[model samples]
Target: MAFRGSLFKFLVVITLYDAFLTVNSQAETTDPTKMTAAILVRVDQSGKGDYTKIQDAIDAVPSNNTELVFVLIKPGIYKEKVTVPADKPFITVSGTKVAETIITWNDSENIFECATFTVLASDFVARYLTIQNTYGNGAQAVALRVSGDRAAFIGCRIISYQDTLLDDTGRHYYSNCYIEGATDFICGNAASVFEKCHLHSVSEGAGAITAQRRESPAEDTGFTFLGCTITGVKTAVLGRPWGPYSRVVFAFSYISSAILPQGWDDWGDSSKQSTVYYGQYKCYGRGAITSKRVGWARSLTSQEASPFLTKDFIGAKDWIRPAPTSFRTASKPISHHSDGNN
Candidate 1:
């Protein structure tokens, strides 16, 4: 009788232990955030990898993480609204290929709320991916919204019809990327630089490419496009003033005939013409006519254009090294124009 009671107790203990393990496994499966390990977070929707959702992998990362977290995303169309919060810095999100890996969402008109991929952390980097907003006929559909400091996007494609890419805040660097939009597509108050990029326009009617907002004279914010190609509908203007002190410069860029004769707009505010600084240099194309450009849109001098042509303009020289070698060379001479002397 003693041996029988002992055996029964052992069986009951084994059953309870097994039940505990089953419950714990279910919790880990449903809530990946329970794991706080700062390690490789691979995302695959095929159920062959660690996490099925990108956000779930990101949630697994510890808050205020200073270490480098590489989120390797596989080739798939992930229809998710991803956000790299401010607390999570030094995170690199990479994909197999730009065309193969796509993270997209449909957010329209609401610049503050609507972003397919929103980055609010510093020292963040993204490569070889396409961030897109599917809302084509919306008021202001933004594909990528970046407000992080020392952030960079490489070989990425940002697509939308209106307000496609928002460089909202901080210093950003975009290289060899493609941005497509109609009106104020690349608009923001951030001090950003675009190198060897392709800016495409798809306006059925009339549209403006950029809408930079530099509210205060003390605020050092502007849009600088270097070694880029601007192509789109044959009637799109270069940019307009979103703020009184808005600043935009296109240096060594190839402008398409699609650009309007008046390269810059005053946003129907006559006072902005005097305060806004819209300039261009060494831009060659049928549409890059200085004579037809607005009288207020002055041609930048070598001294003025040299500062913005370098990577230091976005403060990427110290942190972003070896990659942006295009900005390392000395600035080219500024072409003197009869009407450009300000």
Candidate 2:
């Protein structure tokens, strides 16, 4: 009996040692260029990963996936028209940094066809990347067009000249992002919150920051700017009514001198002046002049401005909870530029 026990113990020890060796080998042999994550696809321009193109990595994911599929993109300028299809949900595309990992194309005025990067999938999250339209200051070019629900863009730089960002539909969140354009740079009917972001106007002449298209007051579509900075070269207005009931609010934000004294426009429609809801609550800086603001524009009181200052406006708790909060409340109107990255 003692001899039999000794033999069994020796075999168990040998088995464990072999298993350790196998696991170690697998770890050591993992591709150095590949990033470790819940990554379903790895993209490397150097041809060391699963795919070389961002679109290929996106296509590799199965359709209608409920679980999040991460696409680890290496640092490089991917010059392709990348689109995240509507069928693919819970997709995350991430890179090392916004300046390092760029997805670019030059398409203009054709909406989706001209967009450099378009996301039609819901529950989409993108971080540490730059999306640009290189066509540069001619026609209506869109750098990034997002028509996805529960979509979040963090630490992203979207650069273009005209019609820069189409926040087309659904509820979206943009935090610590840099968006630049000349005309109607941020237009669409989406209920989006620009939190701690920098909005730049590159138009040599006058331009408009936003052109919200809310057809009805019942529709939950508007642009809310909280603790953000609006800086650019041209003299600009806050927004124009793309639709009759268009709504936009800039609360606790820094509006540079570039902003026109009129603050808001009626898009050349005199009747729209009575229907649009354009308001500013406790905003600051040289261009945040309220007394000279357009007669149609409103300076919201505390009670009227409360709802537009929180994540609950987008009902973010239902989908992506804990949207980035603002240190600058309506009462203080301070500039909170730091969202996370320092």
Candidate 3:
């Protein structure tokens, strides 16, 4: 009986130990810290980072990547055109400073091919970078083309002449960024929210700020600017219809004197004036005066403006997040220019 009792005690201890091991294994597997640790790579123009070119660092990330890969670009003007392919998701290409880190190109030929920086991957983020197409004042040159879904831009400066930001096809969010262009600058079919951003028009004549391309009422796509500031070198209209059923909204924003009194345009097609949905709600400034605005535009009521005023317009809360604070170095640090200087 004493021997049987001792064996029973030993078996209980073994069972508890096994259960403890299983629990610990499950805990480790489900740890958020381990799951969210980003893979870090650096890019420097002066050969001081993991890769000399921005594209090379991007290429190093494996296709269909599930982990967050942070591509830290050192300050300098990268003249090469860069594209983040669709397969490489969960990538953050960030610069230390906005003014010092520039990705520039001088392609003026085709609107489809001339973007300086293009994001084709979903779950992509670009922060504190100046993306510019140096084609001034004539052609359809695009500075930054974001065709990826769930992409976010924070504190970025996008510059060009026409079609500066092809906010293309995506559900996107732009926060505290500066977008500058002349004609039909911020145009596309994306459902996007620009919050606290500065839309500066460098138009010499009457240019349009946005050219939304929502073709049908069923399509959930439009451009909403909330708490944004609009300024320009010369007179510009708020937006025009790039598609028959285009939609755009500006709410609680500052519209500078650079805006035309006749707020919206129909893009030379009078028929578009009947179908496009352009509205402004509780906006202030000399440009926000709606008394002289086009008959088609609406002075939206509070209830009507409610939809465009929140991050829910782009459904950003589901995917939008800052780059992870913890990261594992993906490559050896090479000698690179650390000072963020132009």
Candidate 4:
């Protein structure tokens, strides 16, 4: 009878151990965020991932989301127009490889209506992807339109013919990006900083790289390119004034021979030549020669270029963050529709 009691006690201990294991396994599977700590969803062309469409994956994220949702897209050609709504903030759409993962469209109607990927949400991030509008040269086709404040792009390739990057309105940051276009490619009034980026102009004739539209002097809107490289197929000007008070600065950048000697254009309105603030500082290469630059454009001094040199120009220190490494699975799916406007 004593031996029987010992066996019974051993069986009880074994049962308790199995129950503890079951509860722990359920916790890890049900709420992985407790261990990994980020909301993650995956989009794949194959049936392996959670969603087949990228838009569907984005739709799964809740509106007015305060936490970061990391959407991992598998390598494939996504031929859909994607828009991040204004209510959904703190989202990151990342790709494994820029060359393989492409988001492309052939919309050539209007600049406002034709972007392949539009980011209308603040505190958004895009990484290692190519966003292109294949509307070659006739109309104003925008590959990417960023209208949200504090949007950031890393290792992205933005390509189009005219108005490639409609940096519409925001405090944006592009790092290690490749932006290519022909006319007014990088246009907008966003106070942006392009760091270590490559701007390639595919113009066959005369084209302007930027058309900054800062309407008033009071508006703190401008474009600042630092440690960037500019190349082109044919001659192009550094920028033309899309607004009377438009401002642009290129500092510590490499300007290729494709740039026109005048450096800037008045956009046929000579009045803009005086109001537009076009400046260059410590830039090297054949196109950066200031001797033939327009009289209106300035050769900035060290003191003048100080304000535009760092991420501080856009107050990036407060909002900009690194790509997250850990992740949690997505929860509570939501629905949304795109009307082309945010």
TM-score of each: 0.82, 0.82, 0.87, 0.86
- What local distance difference test score does each model get? 0.79, 0.80, 0.86, 0.85
Ten-residue stretch with the least lDDT total in model 1: 325-334
For model 1, what is the C-alpha lDDT against the true structure?
0.79
- 1 or 4: which has the higher TM-score? 4
After superposition, candidate 3 runs with Cα above 4 Å error: 1-35, 331-342
Off by over 4 Å in 4: 1-36, 331-342
Q: Tell me how far candidate 1 lies from the true structure as C-alpha RMSD in angstroms.
A: 15.7
Writing each residue's lDDT as its tens digit, candidate 1 over 255-301 gives 98889888878878999999998999999998788998889998989
Total clashing residue pairs per candidate? 1, 0, 2, 1
RMSD to the hidden true structure, all candidates: 15.7, 14.5, 12.3, 11.7
Between which residue pairs do clashes occur in model 2?
none
Off by over 4 Å in 1: 1-39, 321-342
